[model samples]
Target: MHAGRRFTLTEILVWTRREILVLFGLSLVPTVLYAGLGWHWLGMPWVPIALVGTATAFVVGFKNNATYSRLWEARQVWGSIVNTSRSWAVFVRDWVGSAPPTGPGFLDARQQLIYRHVAWLTALRFQLRESRAWEHMHEPANVEYARNYRIAERETILAEELAPYLTPAEAAYVLGKKNRATHLLALQSQQLKELLDHDHLNNLLHLQLVPLLVNLYEQLGRCERLKNFPYPRQFATLNLLFVRLFAGLVPFGLLPEFEKLGAHFVWLTIPFSMLVAWIFLAMEKAGETAENPFEGGPNDVPITALSRNIEIDLRELLDELTIPAALQAENNILL
Candidate 1:
């Protein structure tokens, strides 16, 4: 997500410059038709257009609120992941130990659980980053904005990433599965079961740890629900339609009103109309950008960085000196 205090005006304008140019064209056309071409009859009264604007404002507001809710919920899911992951690390580190001294495999079991949990995070983030048909990542404006930073999932292969955290056989098994994250959790449960069977983990601690696993699954399901489902298309379509309709009608509504003030005042319609149209377009674009929080948008949850942070915390808990560094935001964008 944008880690800066707020987006600079220059950045905002640059992001919307193309649309601003289009708005200028939309505004200039009617002003030219009415003022230059003397097409006095082309101008419409402002009252009906203002009425459309009022309705469009409500729709746009509703869309923004809904989209923001989706974004906030996605962030909250990852927040649960952060908490669950730390708890999992704690349980794995403290709970799994030889009750009556075992072999070389005993300590390795604890390490494996922590590493595999990290692998699960990596896989889930990769899955979430997968492009959806409804996502705005492919849109020109989003694509352009994305160039300022890197998406870690896009830069690396899942297999290569998972390799460090899982054994060859397990990684192969996980890669073979359609839902790698779910299968990884299964593997975690299976390992915990084996630990309990081998007398490495107590029945009491095992029970508690299992609930944490359940929590992880619940959080995963929440993330998947957000990733798989999109805001209703009907509302999205109608919101855009209304915004565009109002933007197009803006100059027509303003030109005649300005002409009444003075001959020169009609020229004011071009700038005023463009300003009004740009505001509506910006609002619509903001909602659209927030619609898919996992699509690697600048305003997204920064799951890649969050996953890395979890890995760092878990590895440090393991007392590993060679742990990877935490990801820093590039260009003030963490993902």
Candidate 2:
């Protein structure tokens, strides 16, 4: 996500430059027709335009609010995953005994459970990154802007990311599964069962650990819900149509008002109309980008960084010396 306190002017301009240009062109066309060609008939009535603007404002506001809710929910799901991950680390470290019969296998079992969880996190993030037709990541503007920062899923292969967290056989097994994250969690459950059978984990400890796995499953399901289902297309489509309609007609309405001011003042219609249209267009763009929080946009939840933080914390719990450092944001954006 954008770690900076606010977006830079250059970033805002770059994001909205295409919309601004279109708005300017739309505004200029009507001003030129009305002033230069004396096509006074080109001006639209102010009352109808005002009504349309008011309606567009309401629709855009609803769309933005819905989109924000989706973004915030996605962030909360990941937050739960972070909290559960730490809990899993502590439980495996403290509850599972490192004693007799359990022997060396006990330590290996604990490490395996944590590492498999890391693999699950890796697989889930990669799955979330997979492109959906509704997502904006494939759009030219988003793709171009993405070049400014690293996208972990795009920069590395899924197998490579999971490799460090799983053995070759386990990684291959997960890769072969349709839902790798779910499969990894199942494997974790199986491992916990084995630990219980071997007396490495008691009945009460197994009960505690199983619920955490269930919580992870629920969290994964929550993430899947957001990823699979999009903001209602009917609402999104109508919102765009309304914004376009209002923006297109704004210049027509302004031309007549500016014409009454004076001859030279007629030129002011272009900038004023462009400004109004740009606001609506920018709002539409913001909602569109926010609708899909896992698309690796700068505004998206920093899932990769969050997963790394979990990994570092879990690995350090094992007192491993080679723990990777926490992820650092580049260009004031964490991905």
Candidate 3:
């Protein structure tokens, strides 16, 4: 996500420059038709245009609010994942031990639980990154912007990421599954049961661990819900239609008002109309970008960085010397 205090004007202009150029070109069409061609009938009354613009504004506002809610909810889901993961680390470290004296396998058991949890995070993030039919990552602007930063899931194979945390056999098994994250959770449950069978965890400890696993699954389901579903296409399509209709009619309405100043001042309508059109387009684009928080956009949740942070935190809890450093934002974005 954007980690800076605010988006710079330069960044905003750069991101929307292409759209602005298109709007400018479109605005000039009717302005030239009205002025140079003496097509007085081409001018539209300001009242009808104002009504359309007002309606479009309200629709766009609603869409943006809904999209922001989805984005915020996705962030909260990942936040819960972070908290639950840290709790898992703490519980495994403190609660799993021999009854009287430490055994050779005691530390290994703790390490296994922690490592497996890491593998789960890796699988879930990769799963979230998998492209859905409605996602905008393949859109030309999004694809172009993606070049500015790296995305871990896109850069590497999921099996490769999971390899460090899982044994070869386990990784292979997970890779063979259709829903690797779900399968990984099942593996975690099985491991917990095995620990109980081996008397490494008592009934109370096992009960505590089970609830955490359930919370993880619930959080996973929440993430999947957001990833699988999209903002209603009907609302999105109608909002776009209204915005475009209003933008197209803007120059027609403005030309008459500006022409009242004088024939020479008629050209002023082009820039002003284009500015209004660009604003609507920018707002629509903002909502569109935020609709899918897991799509690896600059505005999306920083799941890759979050996963890495969880990895580092859990590994540090194990006091490992080779723990990787946390991810840092590049160009005011983290992914």
lDDT of each: 0.91, 0.90, 0.89
Which ranges of candidate 3 are over 4 A from the true structure?
A: 98-107
Q: Which 10 residues in a row give candidate 3 its minimum summed lDDT?
A: 98-107
What does the lDDT come to for candidate 3? 0.89
Model 1 lDDT tens row, 1-335: 99989889988999999989989999888788888989999899999999999999999999999999999999999999999999999988888883432223324888888888999999999999999999988888778889999998999999999988888888889999999999999999988888899888889999999999999999999999999999999999999999999999999999889999998999999999999988999999999989999999999999989999999999999998898888998899997
lDDT of 2 by residue, 94-163 (tens): 9877633212332476787788888899999999999999998888788888887999898889998887
Could you list the CA RMSD of all candidates, in the order they appear? 2.0, 2.0, 2.5
lDDT of 3 at 221: 97
- Prediction 2 global C-alpha lDDT: 0.90
What TM-score goes with each of the models?
0.97, 0.96, 0.96
TM-score, cand. 1: 0.97
Candidate 3 structure quality by residue, lDDT tens digits, 101-134? 1123224778877888999999999988999888
Candidate 2 wrong stretches, greater than 4 Å: 99-107
